[model samples]
Target: MPGPPKSDATHKPPFETEELRQKLAEFLDMEVEVPGSKAKKKVGNFQFGIYAFFDYDKEPIYVGQTNEQIRTRIRRHLTNQRTDAVAMNVLDPFEVYQIEVWPLPELEGKDSKDAAAKKILNALEYQIFVKLREESSFKAVLNEKEPGKPDFEVEIPHSYKGIVVSDEVFAIRNHPDVRIARRASTLSRLAQIISERQVQRGLRNTLLTQATRLRALTERRLRGLEEKAKKQGAEPEE
Candidate 1:
C-alpha cells in the first residue's frame, strides 16, 4: 500500500513560544520508548512533574502529574493501565505520538515537599487543560477529568506560532497497529457497558434514567466535535 503523503515543504506548527519550546525540548531529551520486545516502564527519575500527550498534529490532548517519577506515571497511561482514559472513551493511544514533561523541583525531606508539588502540578495541569479546551483549531481533547483548581502558580506554554517538531506523527491511519489499538479501545468500552448493565439488574429503572441523561450529554459533545471538524476543513486534526 502507498505510504502517507510525501511533502517537500517543512512542517509548521500552529503555535510557538520560544521559552516554552526550549523547555519542552529539554524535558523530552531522554528516551521513553513505549512498545518493544522487552517491557520497560518509567523513563527518567523525574520526581515531581507535569506531562502532556500530544497527537499527530502536536496538539495537546491530556495533561497529568506524578508524585514519584514522571516516566512511571506515563507508562501506566501508555501501556498496562489506561482505565481512566478508556472508560471515558476519550484517548485513543494510537493517536499519541509524543509526550513532553516539565520536571518540577523535588524538595526532599522538606515538610512542604508533597503539598507544594501537588499544588503546582494541579495548577499546571489545569492551565494547560484550559488552553487546549479553548483552542480555535483542534477538535475534542481527551481531558474528560475535572479541571484541577489553580492553587499555585506554575508557568505553562501559551503560544504556538512557528516550527514545532517532536516525535514523528505517523499518518498511517490504516496501519495494523492503529486499527488494533482502536479496536481494543472500542472493546474496552463495550466491556464496561456490559459490566455496568449486569450489575445494575436490580436498579434497572434508575440506570435507564441516568443513561438517558448521559446519552444526551454524549450527543451534545458529538455535535460539538462535528462542528469543530467542519471548522477545521479538510483533514481536520483531532
Candidate 2:
C-alpha cells in the first residue's frame, strides 16, 4: 500500500512570535560595558541581576531578581510561562515590550547559597524596586512580594535596555485600541482570580494596579478616537 501523501505547504510558526523570539535573542546577546572593567560582557550571561519589564509606553510593569542566569530567568517568564507570576495570572507576557537589566558582574562566580552573595543580591533588588517604583506613574510594580529591606543602599550598576519586539509586532501590539482591549482582558482575569480565592494583600494590590492601568489606557484610547471624530466632522464635505 502507498503511504499517505505529504502536505505540499510547509508549516511555519506564527510571524509575530517568531519575530519576537528573534528580537529577544538579539537583545539578550548584546554586550555591555561592565563597571570598572575594560572588557565587555554579554548581559544574558550574568548569574546575578535585577530585571524589569516595561510596556509599550515605557511604563515599568514588573521587576524581579535572579541568581540564575538572566537569560534563563527571563526566557522562563516570557517564553515558557513557568514562572509563578505567569501561572498566577499576575503577569501577561504579551504586555512586555522592553526589558532592562542591571547585571551584577562582581557576583559572577559567587555561590548562590553564600550569605554574602544573598545579601548583595537582596540589596541590589531592593534598590531596583525603589528606583522603578519612583519611575512608575502608578507608583507600583506587579511583583507580588516586595524585596527584603536592606540596611544599606547599593549603587546600581549600568543597565542594558532594549526593545524585545520587532517593528511588525510593535505595529500591531502598540495600537491604542488593541492595548486597551488586552489590558482590560488581563485585568478581568486577574480580578476573577482574586474573587475566587483567599489572597494576600500583595495580590490585592496587584489587582488594584491592573485596574488603574486598564482605566488609564481606556481613557486615553477614547480621547484619541473622539478627537479624530471631531476633526473629521469639522472638515468641509468634498
lDDT (tens digit, per residue) of candidate 2 on 192-211: 88889999999999988888
RMSD of 1: 13.3
Give the TM-score of each candidate.
0.50, 0.91
Which tens-of-lDDT digit does each residue in 1-238 have in candidate 1? 9766655343743232233344344443444433322533233454566677775446565667777666567656654456566444445555565576665543323343567656776787777667665661433345545455774567763222222233233334434445445545544564466566554332333233234433544555567667888888854446
Error of 2 at 74 (Å): 0.5
Residue 86 lDDT in model 1? 46
Q: Least lDDT summed over 10 consecutive residues: which range in candidate 2?
A: 4-13
User: Cα lDDT of model 2 overall?
Assistant: 0.88
Off by over 4 Å in 1: 1-43, 106-113, 136-140, 157-238
Each candidate's lDDT (Cα)?
0.52, 0.88
- Report how far off residue 146 is in candidate 1 (Å): 2.5
Candidate 2 regions exceeding 4 Å error are 1-11, 234-238
Q: In model 1, which range of ten residues has the least summed lDDT?
A: 158-167
